[model samples]
Target chain A: MQAWDISFSKLKAGYGSHVVLTDVTAALPAGAVSVILGGSGCGKSTLLRQIIGLSKPLSGEVRVAGRDICTLPPAEFRRVRRRMGVLFQDGALLGALTLAQNVALPLTEHLNLPAEAVRAEAVRILGMVGLSDFADFYPNELSGGMRKRAGLARAIIAQPRILLCDEPTSGLDPITAARMDDLLLSMHRRFPEMTIVSVSHDLASLNRIADYVLVLRDGACVFAGTQDALRASDDPYLVRFLNRDGAGDDAAAGECAAPAVQASLDRWFAS
Target chain B: MPQRNADDISRASPPVKVLRLLGRPALRALNAMGSVTLFMLDGLRHIFTTRRILGRTVRQIYVIGYQSLFVILLIGLFCGMVLGLQGYYTLVRFGSVGMLGSAVSLTMIRELGPVLTAIMLTGRAGSSMTAEIGVMRITDQIDALDVMDINSVAYLVSPRIVAALLSFPMLTAIFDVTGIFGGYLTGVCMLDINEGAYLYRIVSSVTMTDVAGGFLKALVFGLLVTTVCCHQGYKAHLRRDSVGPEAVGSATTSAVVISCVLILAADYVLTSILL
Candidate 1:
């Protein structure tokens, strides 16, 4: 359980012929829950992809534990990736495999563990996610919240040093989202050395689980500090986002006055 | 404003518009070919590089090969019966009814057996493979594999390719045997042909070379159909607005059409060489 910090320096990422994020630089502290906050299409997911080595940056470097992963060869990159786990937005569980089998996939693929051990570990992790009873069910048979929980169990089963979650609370009810936030915080507490980077639009979940916050706007790191610092700041985008005023629309004004700031603050803290 | 639009249309002209329309797809096809070639090469490399995929390849053989046995057998029987009926009537008119055995056996071994087997597989197994992989792509399962440090091509595509390559020739052999028996049922049992002449004529006319050539053709057709299907499925995300069943449906249709065309084209080329 060694701590490893993730650093991005001048990282530019995008698809072919389109640039999403540019000149982004940040160092996610070791052994902390770092929440990346941004509206949809703000390149939060894109940056996550770069960090996971699923896609290379358009320019600059992504360093994991002081090693530049951007220049690593395929074999070396895979070695680096083996130390990390990712929970995708849709769970991305193999529909053909049952919940237990899905959780055991990384273990079965990467390790030569005995079948009994694989099954035992898979069941143990499923229990941690409160899904031990649903071990035999396929992903499609599970509810949306169950699927996300199963995905989380799979992500952490390998004991990865870094856990990347993409919108884990998305598409869930408020109660379910709160439970998800609790599970994430519990996971962080359990593996005190693991760095958890979650990209989310859920302000409530962010306030509950985040030890540090990174706010992205139009593919730039507009703010990077603690939740308390973020709340005390007078930044317009942060204020607008914190208030949940027209958060879905990209054209929403950052310069608009925060009319119900006190009520929003109360609601945020209450959740 | 209407006149200005008309002027703009005229400025482009019919020939230029036609060229633009034709050029885009032509370039797209070329690009697809290049990408598919690279994917196939990667798959080939992984076939030897990874030994773990052997079990998956065997499982795939059961799904892609063993499951298709009944349909392939039915098609072979009906096809041979039709060939026997038609050849018998034509040869009878020319007073060469004794040659019916040679005609049916030659046709089955050299051409129809390999070609029809490929077409059936393209429709049955090839389309299914495309749809399965397409679903995996759109659902982000493939991306999940990538992030897990698994080579998606090695884990997914290579096993399928290996299974298809092994199964096709065996399926073609089954088609040949059943087809010959089907011709026997029609030619001797129904057409009043001499039984000794029928069996003897086939024995003398069809050589080891012909059987070998037929097997080679089947092997090639299997590679083509599987490669095309896998390529289509792997590249499903590249298609604009394609998702879920729409992506799967399009990939399945495209795999069948493209595999059938390539089978026919390769048939001509192989015929020239083998014959």
Candidate 2:
């Protein structure tokens, strides 16, 4: 029933010298759906990774519930992680385990509940996701949309106070994406105090579920505020982003292909 | 004239540049070795701390040891039969065909059994371990485990290590027995050597020390192979040579090659120490 606010202070992160996120300072309020929006390579996932403790930031702090997890000892960090859950871009279900077993993993690992109880809880969550009929199936056997739903079921089944979803509806159809957003809204209502952070570029999903919004561009947080403030802002880039316009962007400044490469393509098409 | 970069300007001479080039790879190799050692130590630590490790270990043994039985037996039998035929002919030339049984049994128990069985297993189970974990790493399942506060090493690698430790010696024993039988079929049934003399030579010449030495080699090979495979898979994402599924493929290949080479290298070092 408890939720934690995530705060970032000048966070810098990347692999080796390839910095993906720089000076990303923001507060994702507790008990709110905070959507992180950016272009394909603007460090949304990197920022999420920092919050999840998957990879430590190069410099600065990521505080969950006022404790800077960036410097937490391994044991302490693990305990912090116990209160959090994540839905990866893909389901990331263990291929060796069935859907029921995958959903039950957290309970089995962290709780001393009987096997039947765990199974029952897993099935109940699967039913919540409308996948009760497919509880015995493997992740690979499910469609992409179904997998995402299953992943959500697994992520929320443990009643984590903080849930992070990475690109939750990136590859789904519009209908499925809408359904996912509704499911997320229902989850928020179910646990009113749970902090949910999602990395997404879906403007529709953002409009549907986001109470708070953080927008990144060129490895920097350009906007962090409520959805209404985000929409009302007159920033040219944000306006263009909201309108789905591509004018004056880098791609618009260049030829689609090199002249030589275009000529080669012309020759191929001539064939 | 070509423009010199800052790095080029900093380098003093051709000889120094060559030394630097050589040193870079040497340093990298050392770094890799250190990483593998630490990874193995971490997995071993988790093996002690993880609850219900026996259940996981048993499952891994079924996969790594039981599933690998037929191939090991087939290879072991042929190796012993070949040794039997070779030893008989060589001893016959020396007018000491009676020593054929000692030759076959000793060669098998001391050297071929553990080494060959490990090499076979490296190809079979070790490669599978690398691929399985590599796929999991790329697909984010490992990250999923981490997010759930599950120790990924304990959940994945430690059980395989424990399984390898128990199964290697057992499989080696099976290899030795099957191989000795194969030798009997060759030396006695096919080559018409006296069965009693062959049996007596094996019983008389083979010592408990030899058997223990063979088992020691097997255990060492098992540890090395499993550690190498697990390390490769665990670090597949960090490899400079590839990415995604290609990285997994590269890791699997490296696991098998590295495990086989380490088996031979460690066999030499262990044989010397045990001797």
- For model 1, residues A121-158, the per-residue Cα lDDT tens digits are 99999999999999999999999999999999999998
What is the Cα-based lDDT of residue A180 in candidate 2? 91
- Which has the greatest lDDT? 2
How close to the true structure is residue A159 of candidate 2, measured as C-alpha lDDT? 85
lDDT of 1 by residue, B1-275 (tens): 65775576578979987776678789988988898889889988889986479888998999889999999999999998999999998999999989988998999999999999999999989998998888999888999888777789998899998999899999999998889888888999999899999999999999999999999999999889889999899888777656667878888888899999999999999999987
lDDT per residue (tens digit) for residues A138-198 in model 2: 9889999999999999999888889999999999999999999998998999889999999
| C-alpha DockQ of every model | 0.54, 0.84
Model 1 residue A25 lDDT score? 88
**Among these predicted structures, which one has the highest DockQ?**
2
In order of appearance, the predictions have TM-scores of 0.89, 0.96
The 10-residue segment of model 2 chain A with minimum total lDDT is: A247-256
Model 2 - which docking category?
high
The C-alpha stretches of model 2 lying farther than 4 A from their native spots are: A249-271, B1-10, B13-19
